[model samples]
Structure formats: structure tokens, C-alpha cells
Target: MNKISYIRWFNEIGIDDVPLVGGKNASLGEMYQNLTAEGVRVPNGFAVTAEAYCSVLEYNNAWQSLHAALDGLDPDNIRDLQARGEKARAIVYGCQLPDDLQVEILQGYAQLKREYGETISLAVRSSATAEDSPEASFAGQNDTYLNIASDDALLDGYKRCLASNFTDRSIHYKYDNHFDYYKVYISVVVMKMVRSDIGASGVMFSLDTETGFKDVVFINAAHGLGENVVQGTIDPDSFYAHKPSFVMGYRAVLKRRLGSKEKKMIFTNTLNTGNIAVEYTKNIDTSSEERSHYCITDSDVMVLTDYAIKVENHYSNKAGSYKPMDMEWAKDGLDGQLYMVQARPETVSSQKKGNILEIYHLKERSVVLLRGRAVGTKIGAGKARIINDVKHLKDFQPGEVLVADTTTPDWEPVMKIAAAIVTSRGGRTCHAAIVSRELGIPAIVGTENTNEVIKNGQAITISCAEGETGTVYDGLLGFEIQQTDLSQLGHPKTKIMMNLGNPDQAFSFASLPLDGIGLARMEFIINPTPRESPRFSHGEESGKLVLT
Candidate 1:
């Protein structure tokens, strides 16, 4: 107990502790230790190390059996994968923590209780040691227990988080990333839960997620807990702020799009989840007035922009490179203050190769079936397969496009094979978008009504290359791929600075041999005053984008 190896306080750990505390906790520690004085409001917390999880399972003699259950897991074999994953999880969950670790865990919880009082509801989140990397972002591959109000619930939540390491998505992700299943570990982050259930919660990216444009901050916010937004269960209000112009004290607000926000996830006292009673969160329909208004104010957007840029700059400097960040934030209704909960590297756009340009031009334009937030620049044509329920996805073919309201980690198997993906809800950072980017496939999300309009087995062409507004053509439309290797092309004699507005074209513009960006317009000059979507046509002289 005196050695103190099982737990790490947020201030006591740094990014180097990822092996022990996992990426999420490590990043939280990094921000906590480094950025609080800078006004980045990160809630205080502690993390139960992976070593603790390993020791508990080993001490209980369940380690080998758990490994045995998942050994040789064939990710492609869905049924087998499920059976083995369940077995492995049960094995881990059944294991009891050793006396020493249990005492330490209680002591850790006591410290929080002393600070926040006895009934301090906590947020228990899982952080895999290998997650949040540019090559492999394990998006929602595990469980998150919110509003856990007691030590017993905390212990159970801890075990549940560890067990989630063997979830279907986690297993497939490990296999796909060529990770050693045995070596990968899960750390449990128990943080002071924000009362966003009374305020707002959401996720934000330091860069334009759709275009990999690093000069803008893209945010998706909802009325309650962040799970709804992160889970793609709700199409949250979207906001954009130009970082450079914002920093220069110019009118930084770029665009704001209102979502239907028909539902909001709120905290509940307790619920029985598979016989275990735990503090749970529930989703309920939003009022017409709540649906009509924005979750956070415009002034709040600017404040978030400041915090996001600071965090991104800090992480980017730590890595000695530009590491755009993916962060989660919440507004404490009691205090009416915004607090940053978590931050990690913005994986997809940051990791993409900006040296080459690949444009998809539809040779034959057809009736535009629908439009949405585009993910990736690729184009895909396939039979539209309406997957209303995940159970019906068994008949989904490799070359077909998956059409759904939303996609979860459980949908990865079908997602890997699909030529393209179309979802009626979710934004660029949602599950569908994250997975599609990883699978190197195109996806159109937040379409509103694709499931109603697009028929099953109908041939459709999905294009994300023209701009941010991804268009789904009625039929299989022939397209031309214009590949431009900037490395192969020579620079022009005169410096060619470009005028930019549409966020979509920024990625493509970066591939061109340019002197610099002349301007990055902060107003709605290029795009029509957007009401619900960011993907709009470009307008005049408006220009100002500082990529360099």
C-alpha cells in the first residue's frame, strides 16, 4: 500500500504514463498538470492503472482463462467473435480485486469524497493503452459509466470498464490494427462528473474534421450528456470558428447549424443494467422550444475556441508537431462554466497525406438524392442497402452501401466491407464518420431522411470530393478521379496565393502548390447563410486561411 503503484492522480501522471493509465487519462493528466492556470477547466480526478486490472485478474486466477477465451478470435466470424468476447468479459468481470488494490481504490475514492463531499457522482471511462493514435483511434470501443454515485458503484464500474476491453469493436480494432491482444491493456478513469445533464455536453475537434483543415475548430453540442452526441444518437448543433482570425481578434464565428435535436440524454437516479443496479443516464424527447434553440451561446463558442486552440497548441508543441486535438467538453449548469473533460489527438485529418490530391468528378450528373456532412474525399458507388436494424445487416454485401440512422461500434463488421456508408444522423466525428475514415471509405452523415427516400438495393453514387456537401446521386453515376501529385508538379514562377471559404476545398487546396492563403473569411460570404448544414456553395473575395 505504501508503494502506491495501483493508482495515479491526474497531476501525478503525464502523457508518458499512457502505458499505465492509458491515453485518455494520460491526456487528462497532461492537461491538468499543464493547462488549468491557462483557463482550461479540467475537472480533477484519479485513474486506476492497468497494472491494477492485470493484478486483480491474475490474483483471482482468471487471467489465463480470459486469454484462452479470446485466443485466436476470428474478427470476421461475427457469431464466434460475440461468443468469445462475452466469455472473455465474463471471465474478467468475475475476478475480484486483491485486498491491497481494493484498499487503495477505496482510499482514492475517499480523497474525491473529501473534496467533493460523500455523494459526488463520478464519470467512469475506459482508456485503452493503445487508443487515440493517428493510425488507430478506438472510438467508443468500450463502456462509460456516468453518474456513478458511490464507492461500490465505482468498483463495479471499474471492473466493467476493464471487461469492455474485450468488446466486439475492441477485439476487431485490435485485430485490424495488428495489435497484440494480450499486451493491450485498459485503464479506468474516474473523474468528477460534470452536471451537463442540467447544462450541455459535446465533442469538438481542433481542426475541420471533414477537410483536415487545421485552421478551424469544429464542434457538435447537445442539451445533455456527451454520450448522445458521441454515440451519434442525436444530431447536435454544429459550430465553426476560424482559429487564425479568431486569435487575431476578428469576428471569428464562421457558421452555426441548428440540428433537430429531438432527444436529450439526462442522468437518472439508478437503473438495472442486466441485473446490476447502477446509476444510469437516459435519453428523452426534447421540447419544441429546446429543439429550436442552440445549446451554447455564440459567446460561449468563442470561449471554447480559445480553450481548444490553447489545448491543441500545447499538445502540438509537446509532440514537436501540429497535433490537432479531439476534445470533450461540458458546461456545469450549477456554475454556468464550461469545463474540458477529455482531449486526444485529432486522428483522421491530421494523419492524412496532404501531398496528393484525389478529386471525384461525376461525369454524368443525376438527380441529387440527398446531401450531408461528407466524410473523406473518396467516392463510392454501390447498391443502397437500408439497414434499419443491425440484425438485418447479415444480408449486407461487400460492395453495397450501408444506409442507417446511426452506426455503433457493433456495426464495424458490416462497415469494413461496405463500398460507402450513408447515415441519416451524426456528424463528421460520429461513429460512422470515424470508422469510415479508418476503413478508407466515403460516408455521408446527418442527411435527415436518407432511410425514407433511398430504396433498398437501389444503385447509388456517393461523392464527397466536390466539397463538404456530399451528394448521393440516384443511380450509379460515372466519375473521374483526378489524381494530382504535388510532389511531381513544379512550382509556378509567381507565388499563387489562393482565396478560400468553403471548408471542404481546404484539404484539396493544401495539395496544390500555393504561395499562401490570402484570406480565411470568418463570415457567411461564400456559403449561403447556413441554417442547418455547414456544407454550402462558395461566394466572392472572402478569403483568409492560415495553414502555414
Candidate 2:
């Protein structure tokens, strides 16, 4: 218990420990404490308390300097923001951990090493906490250091995480969210690393990412670490599992789409390798055979789906309402097992009331040029502007469709002006998809060949209205929009069988008068080709017809 001052094991803490350990660690702790008994695998870890962060800053007498550096900040001024952020971070990075804290940290590391092995690698994550701001609300507030193997490496990574609290992106996140800089404290969580580099990893959501549908669990998977999918570096293999059907012992995997997992991230043996600035991990190209094969099996997806549903239900019980979950999972190559790395309440879709229904109909169907994960529920048409690098961000015109390999929060300024976004990488939970959803801009993400196939300055239409898989049409075809207040609508009873094909229309039709679906032809509702759907794209049987 003497180590309580510096380290709190994940199993010992819960969601209520957010103030002390921060949301990320507290969530991991919550799952480890509650869900492991139910067979939801959470890797063991410990959190370096937020109090430790304050103690380190106070011990070095750097708090005043750090606060002063961020006094007159201008979030709009790019150069000024960068300078101040770097300066504030430098103050924290310059400070040393107190002797007692260092000893406590080493002790925690030693315990983990003893459990895993002498060469155990840990993922050092920075969890920022404050009174009003939930961790999910402010996306990417700090850096995560993965694959740390040594004592010095762990300590160094911890300090870097502390410093990341003042990163320019973190500053932007804080400024946007109106969080008091000093009030937020950063806790470093040193957790056991999953050997995903040798296997596969990806992200999961208890509900559909697009349209805020709650009947299905959406999963995006890829070879190597989950970062590739989260960062939109890879078009991860997509799967939709029907939660209701799964419970009834049916083939719950309603649909599956194999992704062109072009690259996989793996642990690097050497510290520094040429131009690559990353220390622990490196990205390498995947074989065509590897890309072609689905990394996870059907049984794997079902198990993951079952666990995801458990997480959502557990959280919903705690909140006294429905609470969807956004979780990260990894497959350990050595153990051949799946582990939930992290879990947080899905901030976006869960909050939506689905009160307003916008029904989009394409009057003319053109050649389907490209497809990816859909972000928004609407449609957008504009000229395609392919930007390869950040330097060319200035040249982008307003209302242009942003076609890129991927996007970060840094590209928000440009992304806002885009009529729609099309990325060659990333899944529905990625930065590009998340930002576009918040901004109300339609986006097609994880379209593997968008950068190559989509011509620059070409007129195109991006439509997420179809379903889960967004499509980029060859031309700006005519489309109609009908908005209805679903809250005021009444479902009149009648023995009428609805003829449905497109999954997008199913939601709008649900508000209408109808008896139970009479004949929902499996062939009609199911889009055999993966390109046809997003949230409801591969919906099988009557899963697509059921609302809520």
C-alpha cells in the first residue's frame, strides 16, 4: 500500500478514479476490475497517479514558468501556438521525477517485469483529466508511447507523455473545449503491450459508427497495431455483427469487407533508423497475400462482438441509460488471443437523439468510381482536390472534396472547408471520420485507391446516404433531400409488407405506418459487393429493418 502514492494498479481502480488516474487508465482499471470475470480480456497495467504529475512539477519549481509560457496564447496564430506549446512542454520535459516517485515507478515497472518477463514491453499513455472535460470530448490531447522495454526507456517515455500535455494539438483541443490549462493534470499509464505487431489489432464500437444505429457492432481490423486503422493509415477489414441475432445463436456476422491492409506497424529492434523519427515501432509494407486474407476469423469477430456488447451494457448500467462504447482490441500473435486494450464511452453517436431524419435520394445513378467508410448521413458534391502533403493545404479551394491518404486533427482548418472528404485510409473511428461527423461534412474513409483513382480537380459526388460504405460518383448527379421530424411522426398500424433494398431508406421508413416486416428478401436487402454499405451496408435478414 506504500506504493499507493505513485502507482495504482488497473485492477484496483475503477471509473470513479478518473480524478486520480485520468479517464484512460480509470477505464482500463474499470474493465480489468469488472469485466475480466465475465471473460472480457483486459491486459494488466498500473497508473502513475495525477498527483505524481503535480508533485514532479512542484518539486522542480517549474509550474510558474509553465503557466507563464501559455499566458498570451493565440490558437489562430499557427507560429505563436507552436512556439508557446513547445515552450510549455519544454518546462515539463526539463523537470526530473522526485526520488520517491522515481523509486515508486521503478517498483511498479519491476512488478510488471516479474509478471511478464525481464524484457516486457509496456505502452506509456498520457491520460489528461479535468473537472468538466471528459477524455473522449477532447480528441488526441496527448501522445502515447508504445513498445517501451527498459527502465530508462519507460521513464523517458513517461516524461514525454507529461510534455505532450502542452503539445500544439493538445493546446488546440483545450482551447476549443475551454478547459483551464493548469486545472488539467496528466497521468502516465504504463501497461503491458500486446504483441499485435506479430498478429493483428483494430477498433470496435458497440453501435454503428454512422447513423447512430444501435442494433449492430462495427469493427475495423487490420494487420499489426490498431494505430494504422485509427490514424487512417490502412483500410482495415470491416465487419458488422448483428447483436440481436448473435444472442439467438445465428450467423451474427451479417457482413464482412476485406481491406487492402497495405502496411503493418511492428516493433523496431534498433533505436533510431535513418529518416524514421519513431523510436519503438516502424511501419512496413504488407504482402499481397497478407492484404488479401482477413486477419481475424469469424469466431474471433463473434467473441469480440459479444465482449463489445458486454462493455456497452456494463457502461449503460452505470450511467442509468444507454451508453455505447468505443473500444480498441489487439490479437496477440504468440498467445493467439484477443485483448481489449482500451475502452471509452462513444461520445458522438450515443448522444444523438435521431429526432431529425434526412432522406436523400439519388435521382440519377452514375458509374461508381470509389468507395470507403461513410462518415455522415447526408450527401455532398464538389470537385475533388487531392492534397498529398500539408504544405499544399493553402492551395485548397472552398467546397472542394478533400481526397488524401489520411487526415489528422491538424487538417481541421482545411477539412472544414471541404464539401466532402475522401481518404485512402482510416476506419469510421479515425480522426478524419470523427472530425467530418462533428463538422457535418460527408466523408468516404478507407477507400484504398482514392488517391490514385480520384483525379485532382475532378467533379465528384460523395454520398454516405447509401449506407455504411460511402461512394464517390463519377459526376454531380441529381439528388433529392426530404427532411422530416421523426419525433412528431406516428407509426400507424397496417398489415403492409414493405419492399426495401437500400439500407439507408430503412431508417426513414421505420417511422411510417407498418405491421412487422412480411417478406424481407435476403437477396434484396443484402449488398453482396462490399462497396454498397456503411453502417447498414451488409445488413442481413431483418436486422436492417429493426429500429433501436
Candidate 3:
């Protein structure tokens, strides 16, 4: 366990080793060490330690140059930020791995080959120190290389993983979250490839993502790799399994939705004219049968649900509380065995208290202009702003409904300013739905043609108050907010709390009989005030605070 020795096998680490191997790899190691005996299958792998990442920077003298490039750089200046990040990444990518680090990585790869096969394809993924934490999720911000077969490609993938820390989205995320760019290190995780490209792969959440319901497991499956589902490039099959029913021997699958999965991503080998072979992901059309039918059978769905429950229970037992997990699973076409590729603490819903429910109702029934999956339980009215590209986001005004085909993390700047969002693509876990929920805005995703149906500057009403179905009306609509105060009855067993973001609303809500605020967003208070240095009166020391 020498600090300088920079490689660690999955079995040698656990959740406590996050500082060493990063969150994703640490979680993998935890599962490998603790859950393997429970029949939970995880691909064996090794993580290139955070110290190894530092060695690369230290060996190439990149720390000072990277810091200099980032110092005083304005995150708002997109061009400048891009140039600086590209330069920093180039420095890391151009440098060679230290001899010892290289040797260790090669040795680790050889060990994996010994366990699996000599020509075993691998997946090299970036695991940032701050990624997949409960406070924030940097899941899609980093890079992952799949279907790497050769030693050269594995080394290249490792370099690419290290360089991905400077991706535009990653840079912006770190800056916005006030994370130190210098202190955050990247660890590379190299695991046995699951061969999911020849079968089906997808993501699963132990709890319902949209409604914050903990009684069910939500899964999204698609043909070939799981990237198609994660990227929202294709609408995948969705299934829900009721935990209570399953535990009671009912094995009830509450619902299933067949998505129009038109495309699949598979790895392919291509030979150039010079006879040099290259491996990369290739997009292909899915058959009509494939698009129409569910990717996995009912039995497979039940097995996945059971696995989800087992994982949740294991983590809960370890943490001494209910631990909702977000997991990725793939079905190997060759052996037909399911494998858990990744797992992290569920970021949303799990953090929220479920004691009180706020309901909104429309007094008068208006014609529903469009309907889609609801993202929040609220009603909002605003002018429609159809924007198909990010460049046109500047034209969007506050209190306007944003209409788009889909959204990525890069569109977050404008998304924050939107009153409500309507998208033609994406499911509950998509970027638009996730961000909208975080912003506490009403959103309707998978509207199919919201961008084409809604005209710019047209008044629209977004109603997500109803169950599951989100409706967009053509005109401004009246709505009533109803509060079912559970606190007024006999002394409540659980605490009832409110989320206070705006200081203006705090005084009004303070009069309500309830527990103290559960959350007081500090940004809302500080962002509006003028910036100033700390000041103290003559009687008070600099470190001491005096209240008026």
C-alpha cells in the first residue's frame, strides 16, 4: 500500500478509498469486495490512482502552466475558457506516463487478461474525484472509451480519460460549483468490457426518479450500448416494478412503455486503406420488431428488479438508512448473464423529505394543447420561445416557456432563465427533466413535436399538477395552489419542513405552523447583494461578528 504505487485492484478498495480511486471506481470496488458473494456480478477492473494522475502532471511540469492558464479566467467568456481548457488538456494529453506508472498499468491490464482472456476488450472510463457525490453528480461530464482491445488503445484511452477533466462542460461545472481545478484529480478505471453492444444495456434507479416514490424501481433499456439511453439519443423501453408487491411474492411489474428505439450503437472494427485497424462505435438502424418490442423479457425485468432491491438493501444496511441507488446494467448476449456496470448514490429524491404533498388544481378545465411526461407538480404560464439551437438561446426572455428538441449540460445557462420547458425528446432522467426538477420548474418532456407545435411569442400554460401527464395549453390558464397541511392534525411523528429559496417569501411562510426550514438556499440571498469585504467595528475583532 505504498502511496507512490499508483494502481489498485477493485478488490483492494472500497467506498472509503474515494480520495484514492475517485467515487465511481471506489463504489465499484465497494461492490466488488462486499457484494460479489451475494451473487451480484460486477466486471473486474483496476483503477489508476489519483496519485498516478498527479505524477503525470508533476513529471511534465504541468501544474504551474495549468494554474496560470486558469487563474483569473472568466467562465462567462466562452471562447477564452475553451481556449484555456483545450491548452491545459493538450499539455496533459501530450505528456507521457511516468515509467513506473506505465508499468503498473500494463501489469494491471495483464492481470485482467489472465483472469478474463488475452484479447479481452476493455472499457476505460474517467472517474473524477468529485464525481457521483450526493451533493453533485458529474456522471456525464467526463468521458468513457469502450471496446478497447489492444495495449496501445488502452494506453491511449487512459490518456484521453485524464484529458477529459478539461472538457468544456467539466470545466464549467467545476467553476460553477466552486471546486478547485488544481485539487480535483482524475482517476482512470479500466474494466472488462461487458459486450453489451451485442445485447441490451440501460440504466436503473432503485426509486422512481420523477415522483420521488421509493416504492418502485425504474429502468430504461435499449439495444446495444447503454450510451444511447444515457445520452437520450434514442427513446428506450421503460419499466417499473413495485417493491412492495415484489417483496410480497406478487412480482408485480406496475407499468411498461415501449419507446421508438430507432437506432442502436455497436462497436465495429474497420480497416483503413493502409491496413491499419481501428475500433469505434457505429450507429445502425434498429429493425421494426426491435423498435416495437421491449428489449428485455418480463423475466429479465424481474431479475433486474430483484438485483436493484438487493443493491439497495446492501447499501442501506451499510449506511444504517434507506439508500436509493442509481445503477447501470447490461445483459451479455453470449452468456445471457446480467452485469452491473456502475452504481452511485441516487442524487435526487433520496435527499427530499416525503412527509408533505403540495397539490395544484385548475378550477376551470381548459383545452389541453399538448401532453407529455410531467417533471414537476406545478403550473406556470409564459410566452413560448422555440429554440432549436443554443445560439438562439440569447433571444429567450425570462418568464418564457422554452421549446426545444432536446438539451445537454451546455444548455443549462439558458435553461435556468426559462420559466418552463417543453422538449420533443428525452425521458425523466434526461438533462431537461433533471435540470428542470432541480430548478423547481414545470416541464413536459417527450412531447414529440413541441417545438413545431408551439409558436414563438405565443402565450402558453404549462400544467404538471396532474398525475404523470403534463399538459401545455394554448392560452394563459388560472390555477389554484392547495396545501394539505399534515402538521395541523395531532402531533406529527415526522418533522414537516419547507424549502425556502427567496428571502421575500420567508417572512410569509414563517407564520405557518411547521418545523423550521429544511433548506435555505444561500445563493438567492447573496447573489443579489453587492460584493464587499468583511468589515468589523472597533470593539469587535476581524474574526468576530457583531449583529445590529
lDDT of 2 by residue, 1-548 (tens): 55547889997898998899988888899999999999999888999999999988999998889879998888756677778988998999989888898898889989998898887888998887752122345556588888888777788889998998888777876776678788889988899999999999998888776766677898989999878887888778989898989888886997788888899998885765442234678899999899889999999999999889899899889989888888889999989999998888877766666687777878888889998778877889999999888667767888999999899766766786799999988878788987787677899887888877889989999888887678999988788998888778676654676876655445335545555333254544444344433344343653354321
233-260 in candidate 3: lDDT tens per residue? 6777889898889988886897788888
Q: How does model 3 fare in lDDT?
A: 0.81
Give the TM-score of each candidate.
Answer: 0.91, 0.88, 0.84
lDDT of 2 at 302: 93
Candidate 1, 423: how far from true, in Å? Answer: 0.8
* Minimal lDDT window, size 10, model 3: 502-511
Which numbered prediction scores highest in TM-score against the true structure? Answer: 1
Those runs of model 2 whose alpha carbons end farther than 4 Å from true positions after fitting are: 1-4, 130-135, 273-278, 362-369, 382-385, 392-400, 451-460, 473-480, 495-497, 503-548
The TM-score obtained by model 3 is 0.84
Q: Comparing 1 and 2 by TM-score, which wins? A: 1
- Model 1, range 147-195, lDDT digits (tens) per residue? 8887788888888998899888788878888998778898999899899
Superposed by TM-score, candidate 3 places the C-alpha of residue 339 at a distance from the truth, in angstroms, of 1.0
Model 1, TM vs. native: 0.91
Q: How many clashes show up in model 1?
A: 7
RMSD, each candidate, Å?
5.5, 6.1, 15.4
